[model samples]
Target: MKIKKILVDSLQEAIDITKSTYGDKATIMSTKIVKAKKWLFFSTNKLEVTIGIADSEDFQKEFSKEKELYSEIENIKSTLKDVVEVVKSTKQEQKTPPPITQVQPQNNEDFSLRAMNLATKLINAGVDQDIARKILEDSCGFDITIGRLDLKYEDDYQSLIEGLSKNISLKAINFSKNILSILALVGPTGVGKTTTIAKLAYMYKSQGFRTGVITLDSYRTGAVQQLQSYVSLLEMPLRVADTPTRLRECVGELSSLDIIFIDTAGRSQYDSVRLKELKHYLENVPSLEIALTVSTTTDERIILDSARRFSELGISSIIFTKLDETLYPGCVLNACIKANLPVSFLTFGQKVPNDIELANYENLANILLRGLS
Candidate 1:
């Protein structure tokens, strides 16, 4: 592990300095506030931070274990805090949930006649419960807490779809007006990022754009080869870039083309180190617009979290893939509502050019309606 101590005026400055020196994987070993008398009546407080970056895999493993231990400790503290809150509020607030007697059918025959309610449909369609209720209240003004709410789909379906697609933003892919447009796709592992890249490549190449491909995907096994196969089929030149300097060279080499598609390695959203490393490479490429590729099959919470984590690297838009894998792709709309990022393209199947389509207000809302309803 490499350890370094930096002095700065504020904590945020210390963080920036440490990140620039050691990437996002650096651990803060300690921090000290050093007070100094600058003049007879003046004094200044300087922040001293010690940061450590693991140099090897074993060191990183040990650092992870330590982080987990501290996380467990924090969780225990949080639980105790919650317990105290519960004890203090128990006597003042006695709001127990009502019984399940209402959901029970008077007879099994009545149960057979029952159907799913609006709330259940919203939830079963993979929309977050709170978000669905909020959207309903905002759009249709539906009171969800009134009894079983009768688990049945009704006229509110249009209102619910409107709520999901409300204020939704959609960004179009660059068509290369003057200078070459460099588009990159980034996301966590196994979200079909490379496949999506291939899809976009084919989409542009078919439009008669002079296209080129550059890959920062040397870390993944067979990643380069996979992209190579796609570019080969399209009869376009492919370049491999392993470092930031190499990426600049590749971009410059392909500047004469209409569009240069950069395929990046799939890194974990939780891995701050890899994300910052990817950001560093992107900073070298000018006019670079990146789309965060996410899968709709993942949980809504995870989808939102991935969006939050990757936003640090500066995402221009989002590309949702693997919509056919789940019946309840409402999570996509859920993320669109929460993440505040526009959708560029959505891929439904693995058929390269045939499965993807540009996202807009009508189609985005209609896709949710077609699947959820």
Candidate 2:
């Protein structure tokens, strides 16, 4: 096999380059956006794509044969070692009678060992050490006999993680049957609030719901234009509410629609004034659900801090974006657990609708344990 790293402007360009250089059989190992210095105090970002190509057919066959031969040799060595161990055990057993009490000591030792191992696995999987330790310690009084330990330990671990995840708060937009349901997305700058709103607009529109979008993000350049493009493509109503009164009026006008998603301007979490202003926009709005959109690519601490700060706006649910861009996707689990917020959606790429997925406990568990495909 051969591996190469190529820097390109986009993911598509990286794929094209990989295909051209390594043929269609090549596989992409990873893709990340990296910043490079072009000059002093000036930098540009590029996609760093790692790809691999398989060896030739003849070479693969030779490797397979050698692997099988090595496996057989290792198996013979293992069998011989097992036989010697058994012989020594038999001699010992004959020399001295077997211990009358084995189960209690063995069970206690196994219990401690398994608990430590489980905690280590969680930590290795990017769980916060405190969270992982607490989880294991909470289960200390549970039965850890060898029989129970052998009974689907992996499934138990997954269940344990899932249960902890469920403790996090998750709230979805409560769409009314007769009245329009209003959803407002609020988050820090560059967390993809606008893009996430577009994805949700597309999703609801495709479901045949009367969807409309209103943006309170006129502060950012091109924010309205970007959302306008999506609303135009989806053929849904678009409104720009630059002020709290305008937002209320816009909500009143779009109230007839089945779903109305309001996009708020991204403010720094540290900026309490701006955050309060953002909150003021929706404080008077009745029956509105606010979804806090955040990037999964950021540090777990940042994510938690963002959630805490944004909770001032009464975040109903969390929408994690850029899951595809992060190496430690387990941050999703950590963030959800730490913030005690339920996830509304997960967006992995730039594509609208297609890149977004509804959050589920099973799917999150799989990603936390196995990672993204």
Candidate 3:
């Protein structure tokens, strides 16, 4: 083993010098670029070039005066050669040893590149790459292949959904064709229970389903008022229930209506006692279907936990909200898988009736595939 440092104006010049001096027998051990000049080290058959300061007379003067620097470099080369010789001799002495041919991960850039490619796979499989990467890195302490992303679709509209579906059996309350004249929305806080009810009301009224808006969210200031604002626009009747008994009475009175939209207050899954109380209130409302309202952008773990908690309250189906906030929409997939819940609808934006989608499979599949591409 030999170490030769060649100073040249360019990498090409350095390569030429290396080839001319040692032909194909030389290899570059290491190379660096500094300023305008090139510094190259050649070993067996590979050439490593470093560009050094070309225009700086000071660099040249320092190089010439620094005898200790040259000595240090030489010493390093000598030590490396000795080590190599010792390793070879030791290996030869061994009668039989397992061959070690490891694939070397070169640098940080190489690692990140591998991770990015893995990220692409997760995205392709319907997992959001950014979130997946963060989750993988955080939980596993290493980036892993995005594995087994499932797509979910709702079958309520008789429209084929093209994503993964979980078999978590929520007694789905089907209201697609106005079969039931009255319907109620219920769920924990900010689950878009209000907006989803509004969308349903608009759809029912547009189709001449004789829709009415009912609210059990009057306890929260402005909650009832918000429903009123929309009801006023549609010229629809609005009923407010401060207690479950009132909700039961309202349901019976509204039985004659073609379709009733019930909006409930949002609550957290962790608030088990309050949530149970809320559930108990709606328990006697026999004619209403309690659909679980979920947000698409929340953490996947939280979504699963929420669904598990809500499962006790008898969620018929899920209405996923805020689809526009997440980059990779795989959280929906995770939710469905964990809760064994079917999707009924997805809300992409805050737009009233316009932004809501009926969780159709084909359309979602195409969108998810396009994102992967």
Global Cα lDDT for candidate 2: 0.76
Candidate 1 residue pairs in clash (backbone atoms < 3 Å): 115-151, 116-151, 116-152, 117-150, 117-151, 117-152
TM-score per model over all chains: 0.60, 0.64, 0.55
Q: What is the per-residue lDDT of model 1 for residues 1-373, given as tens digits with 9 covering 90 to 100? A: 7878888888888888878877767878899999865887899888888988777785778879999999999999999999999898995554654443334333223321122244456577677776656544433331235433232334555555555455466788767745689899999888988888788888888888888899998877888889988889999989999999999998888888888889889888889999999999998688789899998887767778889999988897989999888888767767877898888998899887688888865665566556733
Using TM-score, give the best candidate's number.
2
Clashes (backbone N, CA, C under 3 Å), per candidate, total 6, 4, 33
TM-score of 2: 0.64
Model 2 alpha-carbon miss at residue 307, Å: 2.1
Q: List model 3 lDDT by residue over 1-373, tens digit each.
A: 4456765556677877767776655655557654543447533333346323233465456657687788999999999999999999997966554332222323324234444444454465456544444322322222223322211112211111211221222233455443544555656578688888888789768877778877877778898888888888888888998888887787777777777888878888899898888888877766566677888777777777888888887876777888776565666655765577777777887888777777755444444434423
TM-score ranking, best first: 2, 1, 3
lDDT of each: 0.76, 0.76, 0.63
| Candidate 2 lDDT tens digits, 1-373 | 7888888999999888888877755889998999976887799998898887777884678778989999999999999999999999998877754332232322324345566666566677677776665545443433433432221235545645544553545555556555778889888888998888899889877877888999998877888898998889999999999889998899888888888888888888899999988888899987688888889777778888889998988887889899877667667667877787788888889998789888876555555556556
Q: Which stretches of candidate 2 lie over 4 Å from their true place?
A: 1-121, 133-166
